[model samples]
Target: MDTGGGMNEHWQGVAEGLRDDTALLLAVQAEYRRLYERCFRDDPAVNHRLPVITHAFRRLGRWRVFLLLTPWMLARLLVPDEPPDIEIPADWRPAARRGAPYTMIGPAFSLELLTGRQKAHLNYSTAIGHYFLHPLVLAMAPFPTPEAVFGAWNDVIAARNANLEKMRRQNPQQEEISRREFFSGGFRK
Candidate 1:
């Protein structure tokens, strides 16, 4: 149970965790950038939300991260996160699909990849990493504009797909589902 002094302690623990967990920090940085561009760039209101989010993130653990994210996810579903309107060629073939409520592409793989690290060495479990750590990182970091974010996403997906096609050989050690599959709005096996 947490007393009133838990906020400072929680933040201290998070900082210590980040110092120890280089991979986790890197993953959080990447997701922070992505989410800022995708979700928070246009809305300056994100600035206001950050403090509350930070407090909640610090106060709660992994399960509560879901408590915060689930509502955001549901709101997004109700109001669909449509890409901004733009002129495009009618025949443009998208290289990768858009993400969904629970897609593994963003923070899941980073947090949960089975890299065989010892339990003691592991910085955070999937729930904590994705829900609390990633969001905390985003709240603290700066992000590019939404257009820049989407543009980068496209470039990354295209390059990755091209490279995957070029190097057709499969490596089980680095196996991953493509963004195309992830955002296909269909069931994955």
Candidate 2:
């Protein structure tokens, strides 16, 4: 029931936040927890396997980006910048006729791969097929890529750190030691 709603007095000093920024960051974290739940929701080792499964998802995403999308983009360069293929006349026949030359058979074989009905893209993509059909490469990024959250955590942490820094910078007595520090050193009086 944590809505990340209104803050109390302790939170009053925080810098201005983006609309639902805290919620969004929490959502991103929740997405990871959901991923963990996907694999271990019913497992006995659910608590123990969170790190393993989350890392696996990150590895899968990197593999898809590097192994599938990178090469697919490169291979597409072989395609000439041309308009859609022209339609065939009703009476026209395919190039593969009986005892035809080997060169003529190439076009007939290409049809098996390209159905031209795909809608997958960079955001949510599969290299070859749809959900059940994606035999080779499939990537689902509902939130930020899990790997990216490791390095680019500024959106979640920067503001709070800035607030703490502001407090440290503006406090005139910061250079002076507090009574806690003074007493901790066993100073008399």
lDDT of each: 0.29, 0.26
- Tens-digit per-residue lDDT, 93-188, candidate 2: 222222222120121112112333322211101111101012122222222333433333345457778888898889957646666677688466
Evaluated at residue 153, the lDDT of candidate 1 is 45
- Candidate 2 vs. truth: CA RMSD? 25.5
Off by over 4 Å in 1: 1-110, 113-144, 169-189
Clashes of each: 0, 0
The TM-score values for the models, in the order shown, are 0.22, 0.23
- Roughly what TM-score does model 1 have, to 2 decimal places? 0.22
Q: What is the lDDT of candidate 1?
A: 0.29
lDDT of 1 by residue, 28-121 (tens): 4455455556665676445422321111222121212211121122110000011112222222212121233323222211222232311111
Clashing pairs in 2: none
Root-mean-square deviation (CA) per prediction = 20.1, 25.5
Pairs in steric clash, model 1: none
